[model samples]
Each structure stands twice: as structure tokens, then as C-alpha cells.
Target: MIKNFKWLLLVSLSFVACNNDDNTTVVEEPVSSGTASFTKYVALGDSFAAGYSDGALFKKGQEGSYVNIVAQQFATAGGGDFKIPFTSDNFGGLLLGGNVIAGVRLYFNGAGPAPVSGTPTTEVSTKITGPFNNLGIPGAKSYHLVAPGYGNVAGVASGKANPYFARFATSSGTTVLADALVQAPTFFSLWIGGNDVLGYATSGGVGVNQTGNLDPATYGGNDITDPNVFASVYSSLVTNLTANGAKGVVANLPYVNTLPYFTTVPYNPVPLTAEVAAQLNAGYAAYNGGLQYAAANGLITAAEATKRTVKFVAGSNAVVVVDSYLTNLAAYGIPSYRQATAEDLPVLTSRTFIGTLVNGNPAAVNGVSVPLADQWILTKDEIAEVKVATDAYNVTIKAIADAKGLAFVDTKVIMTQLSSGGIVSNSFTLTSAYVTGGAFSLDGIHPSPRGYALIANAFTAAINAKYSSTLKPVDLSQYSILYPAIIQ
Candidate 1:
């Protein structure tokens, strides 16, 4: 009886094992590329493409450029040699035919920002002949890339040439786009038009918007390029890059105001003692009284006058300002005066002057009784202008991507994410904050090595998805956050 019972148990166990095997699920590995290729890759863009970090384009920065990172990944998938117009040192600046056209990189000396102590070693006259892979110019705009003689060393003196390009142009009169086309790439990536709106934003709207002006020559260094001009230039670029039937990836611009360079300094940065606050308010009494009087006289609305009223408290408070938008009331013995609101963003440079005494008055600081100048603040209206232009440019870019059937990387989305909730990659969180954020460098405008790695991953994903390629994404955690000054 015992033997029979054991036999039954064994039989039941065998039946259960067979059922488990039949119900087992199989998981297939992710699919890679079907027809995509990265035989010869080229990158065309501005400073970000050149790896201009910490406000300088040095050797290490160039090596860590997002394009370079992408190219390195391409190498694993049968990509060819990739080259850059590498500067001699990691200190950035370049000598244009023996003159300093760009400034040195910035570093933290445990105090504030200071220029890296070194003479530039990259000479513009020393040309690196190509078919080069990394064709990024540090300061090139959308139109500048297609403009003839933009890389001519002789044109540098006349402000028609980019110093960064002069260092590596195949010939004196070649445009950046033409030079890039000469490479005959199998895969390409473009990230232009940033400087189109960046200049206006960085200049605190000191430059013209040039909204209706189609001529690129008439635009100032800080002016915003017309969206039509951007469209024409951008279309020309895509048409030429794709002329060879090469697949490519393109990235849209991020709102410049979201960068640490503009957002680092808060609007309400002023902290005053009760006594100092009272004294400062007393000094503004005349201006406040004038505003109220104007409101009563119908010179300005009572609500506007109230909105422009200056007030200070012992704790954190917004600094008063003389905005350019205010109506000139000097004829009425009233100067257009107002206090800065939460919407205002003081330029990063304003931090140096905010606490400084105005005309040697300790009690009256620059941001206090003196009021910050229009150039130091990005007013709410100016921000609106930036937004409009950004939107228009992105529209043009997306349209081009759709028409060309190329991969598109939405940088603005990721940038906003980085600035707000931050992004986690490989269990590491990276923000858009300067220095410590491990995303942006000391300059706050450009990204650090890790940040570039993140961008490279974005490009890789887009390329893999659009072209049906299996190119692996770069591991962000492997890249260094920031390079040391000494580079030991």
C-alpha cells in the first residue's frame, strides 16, 4: 500500500512540472537597426556643439562635446574617424591670427567667478584641413552658417567672420555650411538658431527684435533674427545636408530665460534691516509721491501707479527699477519709476552690482534706492518676446524635420524637465542649476560633460527610433560632471 501511494505522488509531481513548462512566458530582446548607418557623421551647430563649457571652449570641453559623444557611440556601430578643431588647452579662448578674439574660461576660486589664467594657444592661422567631422563654430548664428566669407580670417577684423571658424576653415572664403557639405556625411546632426534669440535675451533686450527685417547683415550682435530669415536659412541648411541622401538628427531651442545664467539670481534678492529699509523707503518718498500725484492728475492710471509703487520691508524684497516701458513723465516733473515684481529676472551679472554702494552711499545700494537699470533686468514683456520668437523658431524646425523625414530631438522639453523636477539617469539626479547641478558648468550657459552625455543619449534615441537603428544610448553616469581647472 505504501509503494502504491509513493507512485501516485511522483505521478502528480510530474503532471504539475509539465503544466508549468507549458505556461512559461518568453521575452524577446529589443530590436536594433534595420537599415540605418553612421559610416561618416558630422555635426553642424554653435557653441553647444563645440562643447563650450564653463564659458570657454577648451580641449577637454571640445572632447566632451555632445556631438563628439554621439560620434563616439557611432564608432561602435561602424562609424569612421571623427575630428574636431581642438584648442591647445582647456582654458578656452583662441588667438585669431595672434589676437584674443574669445575670452578665457571661467573657474571658481572658492570665492566668485574668475578668468582662467592662461594665454590662448589656439591660433586661427593654423588650419586643420579636412573633411572634418565636428564642424561646430562657437558663435555662429543661423544665417551666419550659410553666409560666405564667414570663416575668412581677413573678415574677422570687419566682424564678418567667426574667430572659432577661422581657426579651421579649409580656405579663407568658405562658409560653415559649405565646409560641412564638403564632408559628404552618411549621418549628420544640426542644432542651430539658438543665438538667433539668445543675443536679444542675453543683452537684456538692448538689441533690436528685427522681427520684420529679412536682411541678416542689418541685425546687431544682440538682435533677434526674423523667423522668416531663420526659416529660409534653416531650409537651405536642411536641403543641402540632405542633398546627399544622408540621414540626420535636429534639435530645437530651449527658452534661454530658463538657464541658470538668467534664473540663478532671484528677483527678490535684497535683504535689508528694518532701519535700512525705512531709510531707503524714505528716500523713494519723492518718487512715490510723484506717482500718486500723476495718478490723481490723470497722467497715469491709479492702478498703474499703485503697481509701480516702490515698497521695502526688513526681509526679502524686490528691487525697484526704472523700466524702459514706463512713459516719459519728466515733462510733468515725474520720472517713470516702478518696483520690480516676481516676474522680473535680474541678469546674472547684476549680482556684482546689486549690493554695491551707489555713488559711495552705503545706505543706498544699486538695487535699493538707486534702482537697477533696464539692461540688468529681463522684464515680463521682454520674456514674452523671447517666448514668441522661440515658438516660431521651433515651429520652423519641426516642420523641416517632418518634411525631411529626419529624427528630431525636442531639447526644450528635456531642458524644462531638468530645470523643474530634475532628471534621473543611472540613479543620479541632474538639474539645470549651475556648478553643483552636475548638468551646467560654472558659466551657467553651457552644459557640463554629464549634461552633454544626456544630450547625446537624446540624439541617439531619436536616431535609433527614426532610422530603425540599434545604437545603444550613452551611459550618463560614466561621464564626469565637471573637469578640474588643472586637468590632472
Candidate 2:
């Protein structure tokens, strides 16, 4: 028994000694503790992405940019300071809000009266702040991002002349986006390509005249954005951003024709007052009779009476209603009976012809029925095209984000909800309305201050979710009013 116990004790001692020697090193594995450590962020996009609205580059509008608001919140939550290159300064220059770039002004100022036909009145504003955290360029298209001389064409600047990017640029003459990425941002938010289709919608189709009337010739049958070009620029941008560990979030484009500017224009021609109707019909009749008289008398080409619209200059006179105008009038009156003749209608659309009432009664000449002209609404074909393009863009955005394990900001859906009155702020109920409503400004394309805050909150939520960081959203209530056009 004693011999057995001794052998057992020896065996235990040997086992303990062997284990101690083999497990000498005790290094702990590294943890994912630094998971929420993104400090620097950059944002890139066009005007809507820039929070440009109303007629000017005001502090209120600029501060409303979702990117700026999110950056401020991030700073409080341990993010590095994210500065924007903006231009919303109180310069004391007394410039009107929408006319910063010398466009969209009174009739005498070259723009003529606000066309009764709904047209966007806002041109691009200046870079109030730039080379900034907000690298949103006005009037920029998708391909324009890498296009040379873009900075110079966009605005005046220090180095290569991109004042907007120059303000925040580390080098002279570098583009705002390129410069921002070169700075090695840890994170980025990109919302681009809205203007690609937006311009087409506002221009009322391509190849259309600037005469402020709806003409089919405008659809010059050209697709402005080349899919290949879009994919290349977008992929390159994403690649560059992630090259330096920049986690990115990209948003999709919205349907351009769905906005208020296009939605509110009356579908029918402007009505006329009884007196004006009589005068117009009388004039038309006289003109018709004269035409018949001239034709019957073989009095053709006798220095044809000068057309009121066309000027006879340097003794050069030509009488030609030609086929274009005549065909247009005949087709309109007979088959469509929708549009008004050039002689019958003013050069521009006007609310004045909303038509005064005669004896407090409203009706067309001879009480004849008139068809409504569909201007604001996109035709079925146009809508389908817009949908297809938007879908493709969204697909690209999602695929890129997923492939790179990044985030995506769906501003397109957000905007649609907004236009449909889905948003509810303290002082605003955003609808697809003009400046009268808080949803959009006189431009009918861009959002008001409240709308911008909503966007900021969206970005903030996405960031919080992805990084496991608890960044609080800005209170929509805190956002102030944007334009005086809105009623209290």
C-alpha cells in the first residue's frame, strides 16, 4: 500500500511540472474596442446635397445642410471637427436670397415675369463657405466631378479657382472633393446626381425653346447621363474614399418631375376675362379675314404686313408664319384643342390670365369648352424613364456600399416622403408646394430649413446604427424658419 501511494504522488508531481512549463506565455488577444473610433468625416454632392434653397446663400439655409448638422453632432460625440466650405455670410451686401449668381430676377432684369408656366427661379448661389466640409457644388452633374476646370467654372477660388473647395483646400487649385479625400478623411457622406435629371425636368424636356412654353421639340431625344460614365466616376470616387480607410455612405437620386414646381402649374391654358376674350377673338377674326382677303386677291408677297412678333430690320422683310407655327396652331385647335395659339396666348405664362370674371361669371369665348394643358405633370413615358434611371442609380449605390461594407443614405425615398407631406416639424408641414409652404422654396426644387433638419437626422441615425455610437440627432424643433414667403 505504501509503495502504491508513493508511485501515485510521483505521477501527480510530474504532470503538474510539465503543464506549468508548456503554458508559460499568457498574452491576451486584441479586442474590437476601437470599433467606434472614426474621427474625421467628409461630404460630397451637388446643391440639394449642399442645402441650397430659396434665392440666396444664407446662414440658415447652409446650416440646414444635413452634412453640417451631422458633423456638429458628431463633434459633440467625439468626432473630430468637420468644417464645411460654405458661402452663407452676412456680407451686408443686401443681395436678394435667390439672385446671388445674377440670375432669376424681375422681368426688367432679363428673366421676364415669373412665367405662369412653372419654371425653377433659383440659379446657383455663391460659395459662402468652402473647401469646406460641405463639398456640394451647384449645377454639377455626375461626370462633372472629374471634369477638368470644374472648380474654375463653378466659382472663383484661390488655387485652381475653386473658392468653395479652396477655403478648406490644403493646396491651391485642387477640387473640393479631391482635396477633401486627400486630407484622409476617416468617414464620408456622399449624395450626388440629383441634378442630372432635375435640369431636364425644369427645362421642360430637351431641345425645347427658352420661350417658357411647352413644346415637344424640347425632348431632343437625348439621355443626358451615360450609364458607363456614371458607373466609372462613382466607382472611382468610392475607391479613392476607401483607399485611406474612409467609410462612406452614398444616397440615391429623386424623381425630378415629382417636385412642386412641376406639379402646381395648371394643366389648362389660362382663362380670359369677358372683355379680353372679346378683344382676342375680334383680333383673331380680323387677322383671319385679312388672310382670306389677301389670298383671294392674289395679293401675296406684297411686302407681307410685318408680323408683330418678328421685327423688320434694315429693310429686310420676310412674311412667313411658315409650317411650324401654322401646323402647331391647326393641330392644337383641331385634334388636341388644348394649347393656345401664339397670337392668342402671351409670350410667357402668367397668372394674370387666370382670367378676370365678367359680371362675376367665368367662361371661355362663346361659352366654348377648352381642354386643360398638361404641363407640370410628366408624361407617362417621361415618368417611366425617370423611374428606370433612378432605379439604376439606387442599385449602383447599394451594390457599392455592400461590396465595400459601407453605408448608404436613401435621400431619394426621404425626399419622396417629404414631397408627399410625410414630414412633421414644429413649425413646418412639408408638402410639395412652392415657397408658400415650408417644404420647398420659390425654386420648387430645393427644401426649406425644416426639410434640411429632417435630412440631418436621417444621416445621424444611420451613423449611430453603423458605428455603434450614440450620436444624438438635432431637434427639428430647433431649426428656424427659412423664407419670409411662408405664413406664420
Which prediction has the highest lDDT against the true structure? Answer: 1
Tens-place lDDT per residue, model 2, 148-218, is 44454233311223223323344434555676666678878888777556555554333233322112232
Error of 2 at 353 (Å): 9.0
Q: Cα lDDT of all candidates, in order?
A: 0.83, 0.53
Question: Model 1 over residues 216-290: C-alpha lDDT tens digits?
Answer: 363357777889989999999999999989889999999987688888888988888998889878888888899
Off by over 4 Å in 1: 1-33, 208-219
Please give the lDDT score for candidate 2.
0.53
Model 1 Cα RMSD, Å? 4.9
Question: TM-score for all predictions?
Answer: 0.90, 0.62
